[model samples]
Structures are given as C-alpha cells and as structure tokens.
Target: MKKWLYVLGISGSLILTGCNGNAEDTNAETENQAEEKTEEVNEQQVKKEILKAQMELTNTFKPYQQKITAYQAAVSAEEPDSETIQSTGKEAKTAASEAASKVEDFTIEADLPEDVNTAFNDSLPSLQAYYEHVESALNENLEEADFTSAEEKFTEFNNQFNEIIEKAGFPAAPDLMEEMS
Candidate 1:
C-alpha cells in the first residue's frame, strides 16, 4: 500500500509540472504575437505619414510645373519670334522665382518617420538648386533672347529633374518637349 501511495504522489507531481510548463509556453507565444502586431502598426503609421507628405508637396508644386510646361510649349511653337521667346522666358523666370520662394515656406508634417524626413530634407536642396539654375537661364534669355540657348537649358533642366524625381520616388514633373508635342 505504501508503494502504491508513493507512485500516485510522483505521478501527480509530474502532471502538475507539465501543466505549469504549458502555461508558460502559452504566455510566451502570446507576448511574441503582441510584439509583432505592435511593430506592424508602427510600420503602417510611418507609411501613411510619408504618403501624406508626398501628396502635399506634389500639390504645392503642381502650378509651377504647369507654368514651365506652358513656357516650353510657347517657345517650341513654329517660327517663334524673339519677342515671344523673351516673353515666355520672363514668365517662366517669374514662375521659378515664385516657386523657390514657396519652397522656403514648405514644411513636412512632424509625424513622419525620421528616415522619411531625412530623405525629403535631402531632396529639397536638389530642387532648390534646379530652381536657381532655371532662374538664371531664364534671366539670361530675357536679357538677350536666344532660342538655341533657351532650348538647351530647358533640355538640361528636364533631364536633371527626371533623374532627381526618379531617385526620390516623387511624381514625374511635366516634360518640356513632351508638352510641346
């Protein structure tokens, strides 16, 4: 009888230990799942914030892009006169100057991820540089309207802008020659 009692006690102890171990494993699995869920939520929020900033920047810059397209179209028209070229240049220059000023006032929302903010911040300097180049080219054209030089500058600007947009994953700006066609 004593041997039977001893066997029952040992069996009961083993069962209890097994139950405790299973409970611990379940708790660990739940914790892991909760952590993964939290990470997914954070990633989603970051994407949302980045998308919002991109849309805002695109909307704000659209008018200036349209002005550039208009200038390109005007100049590319058949047998454009010196007066027409100069007028278009002045208009484009004015638009570029205004765009540069607008860029100064632009702000990304604070909720964006740090990496996204850094990317946007880096992108702005290139845009600013391109705008400055545009202003200078237009100013030169206004002073002594040269269709040859104006066309060259326009091509150069478009190429550079396309490269920049591709790198930054931003929307493509209107193409000058494409608009003319």
Candidate 2:
C-alpha cells in the first residue's frame, strides 16, 4: 500500500511539471503574436496618416488647379484675347495665392511617423516657392510668358509637387495643364 501511494505521488508531480512546461510555451507564443499584431497596426497607421495628409493637400490645391486649367484652355484658343488673358491670369494668380496660403497653414497630426512628417515639412518651402514663381510668371506680359520662362516654371512646379507626393508614397498630382492644353 505504501509503495502504491509513493508511485501515485510521483506520477502527480510529473503531470504537474508537464502542464507547467506547456503553459509557459503557450504564454510565450501568445506574447509573440501580440507583439507582431502591434507592429502591423503601427505600420498601417503610418500609411493611413500619410495618405490622409496627401489627400488634404490635394483637396486644398484642387480649385487652383482648375483655375489654371481654365486659363490654359483660354490661352490655347486660335485668337486668344489679351483682355481674357489678363482676367484669367489674375484669377489664376489669386487661386494660386489662396492655395499657397492654405499650404502654408497646413497642419499634420503629431502621431505620424517621423519620416513622413519630415517629408511633409521639407516639401512646404518648395511648394511655396513654386506657387510664388507661378504667381510672378502669371503677372508677366503674356508675350514674354510664351518665351519659355513660364514653361520652365510650370515644369519646376510639377517636379517639386511630384517630389512631395513621391516622398510620401502618394499618387502624383494630375497635370491639368497637359490635359487642358
């Protein structure tokens, strides 16, 4: 009887030890899965933040883009009127100014990834410069504007805008001038 009791106690001890080992393994696996989930969530959040910022910036400039398109169409006509050019130019300049101001005042969420934030912040100056250049070119004599300088400014602006979008992993801005012309 004593031998039987001793064997029963040994078996119980082994069973408890096996259960504890399995529990530890399960706990470790759970922790690893949780950590992986957290990392995935963070990556997704960063992407979402970048996408949101891109959309906001695009929305702010959409009206200005439309105005520029209209101006381009007006100037492309067979007999472009000087008066129409002047008025449209003024309108385009105003729209550009408004878009620039909106960009200047743009804000990003603090929780965004540092690289995304840096890309956005770094692009602001170029964006402002591009807008200023466009505004100045639009104010020039229409004949002089046709002399390559305006095209250069447009190209520069497109390049800078594309740079910003690319840095943020966003789609390039639509080339309204190309479409309208």
lDDT of 2 by residue, 1-181 (tens): 9999999999999999999999999999999999999988887776677667656666667778678656766788799987887778788888767766876887765467776677667666656665666667677754234325545655665565466556545555545345323
Which lDDT tens digits does candidate 1 get at residues 27-67?
Answer: 99999999999988887676566656656766777777667
- Give candidate 2's error at residue 171 in angstroms: 9.6
**Runs in model 1 with CA error above 4 Å?**
78-84, 142-181
lDDT of each: 0.66, 0.68
Clashes of each: 0, 0
Top-scoring candidate (TM-score): 1
Q: Give me the displacement of residue 105 in model 2, in angstroms.
A: 2.4
Rate residue 160 of model 2 by lDDT. 58
Quote the positional error of residue 81 for candidate 2 in Å.
3.9
RMSD of each: 5.5, 4.5
Off by over 4 Å in 2: 1-15, 109-111, 143-181
